[model samples]
Target chain A: MARVARGDRAAFAEVFRHFAPRVKAYLVKSGAVPALAEDCMQDVMATVWRKAAQFDPARASLAAWIFTIARNRRIDLLRRERRPEAEDLAWGPQAAPEAAEALALQQDAARLARALSDLPEAQRQVIVQAYFGDLSHAQIAARTGLPLGTIKSRTKLALDRLRHAMGRE
Target chain B: MTPRPAPRHHPDAALLMAHAAGTLPEAFSLVVATHVSLCDTCRVELAAHEETGGALLEMMAEGGSGRHEAAMDQDGVLEKVLERAQALPEAAPPAPPAPGTDLPEPLAAYVGGGMDAIPWRRVGGGIRQAVLETGPDASARLLYIPGGRAVPDHGHRGLELTLVLSGAFSDSEDRFGPGDLELATPELEHTPVAEPGAPCICLAATDAPLRFTGLLPRLAQRLMGI
Candidate 1:
């Protein structure tokens, strides 16, 4: 990311190679046609390169940050509206996150991946649909046999665990 | 940064997750963005949700859950993206918001400035409002109430999020001060009255039009577009 921010095409190309396919898959799952997804995927990668300076590893992982960009682009294309973003918290020089903290966050991310895969197939499917499929909570409940309360509790439990892992709880 | 008390109420986990996933409607997103701007606790929670999204994206990539590999021409797409990138200048860092603005950045962008800049229209009683332009899926508005004045009792058909930007308001539930968010679902109906102090200013978003119980308020709702 630092290299990309410095306008290194090599670094940007490496990121594109790794994430382009995944972003395409996400768009497809969200109901974009393959051709549309491919076009949008290109736009998303271009954005990743252009917005590299805004990427803060302390606040989000590269994959997470890219996910947000792709998500925002999808909303613009599909919904025809810009999604409102939260105000940027002012980060002073003295407030730079510790190297150890960033490392811990990455490790927790790995744990979260493992935890997600370990979830029951039904639970995981609903979660995947919620994010990539663009289904609302109510829609997810209605589509699946699971009750609304069950779906909410399942996601809530995952969020609680993530908060604990992030050391925010 | 001035230290304000953390918000006592927040959007539920589902709403935060939707926002992180970028699936929330524009009106709801506005409320969430403005609330998260003021509340660090919800900011951390939102980050957690985004992290979850990151993990899911990684998992999908590793698992190759879709047929994208068969259909996508990776090298061809990369060439196109590189071409586009060459023409595009890198984005500059966002400038800091003007000092002493009463509204958060997202809301301020919608309002064009702070409290003084709002083009409030009278919505009857001592309350005024300015409906913000969002997508058809939902609506967002800024509301101003004189100190101790009461907004009409209303119920929501869908979700309604009220975020206090300045001063305070009290409903049947509790007092909502600056940065505090109150989420009203269809099941709850209450009248919110501004607390005695400065006039209360709030940014409110509702997925469905509010259902006012009073006959006169219902007529006002038609004319006022509330």
Candidate 2:
């Protein structure tokens, strides 16, 4: 990300190679046709390059940050509506994150990924459908039979780990 | 200035998840965004959901290359994106909010300025509202209730989200101060009265029209488009 922010085309190309296919797949699962998904995926990558400088590893992982970009682009292209984003918090004197904090966040992200893959099939399916934009909160509640609180608690365990790593607690 | 107290009430995990997934209706999204701007607790929760989304995206990538081969023209897309990147200028950082503005940035953009700039219309009972333009899925409004006055009793047909921005209000549930969010489902019914002191200001959103119980308020609802 630092290299990409410095306008390194090679770094940008490497990032594109890794994330482009994944973002395209996400769009397809969300109900976009192939051609539209391709177009939208390209737009998302361009935004990644443009906003590289704004990426803060302390706040979010690279994949997580990219997910937000792709999510916003999907809204623009697929839904054709404006998304209201929360105000950016002022981090006060620390313009750049501490190196140790960034490393800890990355490790926490890896653990979260493992935990997600290990979830029971039914639970994982519920999460996938919800994040893929195939289900709304109401539909998820109605279809899963599992109460929303149960799902929240499952995810909250991982979130608590992340919060501790980020020193929020 | 003394920092505002942290919000006690917040939107549940389901709402935060929908917001992170980009599936929330625009009106509801506005309320979530405005509330999250003021509440760090909710912001962290939102980040957690976004992290989950990232993990899901990664898992999809690992599923197989078969889907990727069918959907994307990789070299062609990369070439186009790179071409665009070459011509793109550096993205400028977003401008800081104006000093002394009370509304959150997202809500401020919709209002076109600060609270004083809203074109409020009287909706009866010492209450005023400015309905914001959003998608057909839901409606959002800025509401002002004079101190010590009670908003008409009402129930929701669908979901109703009320986020307090200034002062406080109390209903059958509890007192809600600045940054607090009150979620009302169809089963809940109550009359909210602003506490004495400052007038209560809130950003409220509803998926369906509010069901006012009183005949007079129902009449006013139709006339005022509440």
Best by TM-score: 1
Tens-digit per-residue lDDT, B156-204, candidate 1: 8999999998899999999999898899999999999998868999999
| Model 1: CA > 4 A from native | A94-97, A145-147, A161-169, B61-72
lDDT of 2 at A129: 75
Mind giving the per-residue lDDT tens digits that candidate 2 earns over B91-203? 78766666777688889988988888898998887789999988778899999999999888999999999999898999999999999999999999999999997999999
| Candidate 2: segments with Cα more than 4 A from true spot | A140-169, B62-73, B87-89
Q: Please give the lDDT score at residue B150 for candidate 2.
A: 89
* Residue B78 displacement in candidate 2 (angstroms): 1.7
Q: In model 1, what is the error at residue A8, expressed in angstroms? A: 3.5
The weakest ten consecutive residues by lDDT in model 2 chain B span: B62-71
